[model samples]
Target: MKSSIVIADDHPLMLKGMMNYLSSLGYNIVGSATDGSTAYNLIVKLKPKIAILDIRMPHKTGLEIAQDCKLNALDTKIILITFDKREDVYKKAKEHNIYGYILKEFAVEEIETCIENVICDRPYFSKELVPNLEKTYTNTDYTSLNKLTKTEIKILKQIANNKTSIEIADDLNVSPRTVDKHRSNIVNKLKLHGIHNGLFIWASQNKDIF
Candidate 1:
C-alpha cells in the first residue's frame, strides 16, 4: 500500500507546491497544515506513516514536533524540510532521528527520493549541501583529515561552520568540558598549536573540504 503522509509548511506556496507534487505522484496525503500547532494536531489525529514538516514554524518548530512524536512513541517517521544548512540544525534533526531532511531549494527534486527512502526505513539528506560548499571554494583537499577520528572530524566540521564550543557541545549532546577536551585534541591532531583560534581558522579556510 502507498504510505500515508501528512505535510506542513507555513509558506502557502511552498506547502501547495509540495502537496500538489506529492499528490500527483499517487502518495496518500492524509493531511496538511500551514502552521505548527495545526500540523501537530493533524499528525496526532491522523497518525500518518510520515510527516513532512517545515523546520521552523509559528507555534512549534519541526524539531519540537518530532520530539513530541518521540515522547508519545508515535509510529510516524519525520522528514524535515528547510532552507537552513546550519550544522546545529542538522545535528538536532539527527538527534531526533529525522528520517529525511531536504533543503527547500531542492525540495521538489529531492522529495520523491526522500519519501521513498524514509518509507523504506532509510535516512536521506539533500545533496545540495555538498554542492553548495563546492560553489564557494574549489580547493577540496582532504589530506589532513585522515589523522582525526570521526567524532573529532565532526567537531571540526561544526567548528569550521563557525559553531562555538558551547553550541557544538549542545548540538552533539556532550558537555562543554568534553567539547573543550576534544578541541584540545583537535588542535593537537591538526597541529594548529600556538595559533589563536587556529583550529577554527583552518576549518573555516578549508570549510568546503569538510
Candidate 2:
C-alpha cells in the first residue's frame, strides 16, 4: 500500500505547493491542514503513516505537536520542515524523535527520499544540515548526559524549551513536586550549583546534549 501522509503549513502557497508535489509523487495524500492545531488534530484522528509539518505555525509549533504525539504514544511518524538551522531547534527535533528534518529550501528535492526513509523506520536529516549536526554531536558532552536518567533527559529537554515546572508536570502527567524533584536531581547531576537559573542556563547552552 502507498504510505498515507498528512501535511500542515501556515503559508497558503507553501502548503498548496507541497500538497501538489507530494500528490504527484504517488503517495496517498490523506489530509492537509493550514495550522498547527488543526494539523495535530487531523493526524491524531487519521493516524496516517506520516505527518509533514512546518516548524512554525499558528497555535502550536511543529515540534510542540511532535512532542505531544510522542508523549501520547501516537503511531504517526513526524517530519518537520523548517527554514531554520539553529542547533537548538535541531536538538529539539531529535529529542522529540522526529523521523525527518527537511530544510524548506530542499523540500522539493528531498521530501520523497525522506518519506521513503522514515516509512522504513530510518531517520532523515536534510543533507544541508547533516554536517553541522554531526559537528554538534561530536562536541556534545555525552558523559554528562549519561549521568541523567531518561525521565531527567525528557524534563531537561522541556526545560531547554523554556517550559516551567508546572508545564512539564502537566505534560508528563506528574505532580508539580515530582517535576521539581527531577529538576533538582538534574541540576545536581550536572553540577549546576551556586548559579542563578543554573538548570535553565545549562539547558540553553547544552542543547545538543538533550
Candidate 2 C-alpha lDDT tens digits along 1-210:
489999999999999999898888788999999998999999889999999999999998999999999899999999999999998898788778788899999999999998987786556779898667555334545687789999999999988776778888999999999999998898788776653345664676577756
Compose the digit string of candidate 1's lDDT tens values, residues 11-56: 9999988888899999999999988999899999999999999999
TM-score of each: 0.62, 0.66
lDDT of 1: 0.81
In order, the Cα lDDT scores of the candidates are: 0.81, 0.85
Q: Stretches of candidate 2 above 4 Å error?
A: 139-210
Runs with alpha carbons beyond 4 Å of true place in candidate 1 = 130-210
Q: In candidate 1, where is summed lDDT lowest over 10 consecutive residues? A: 132-141
After superposing all C-alphas onto the true structure, candidate 1 shows an RMSD in angstroms of 10.5
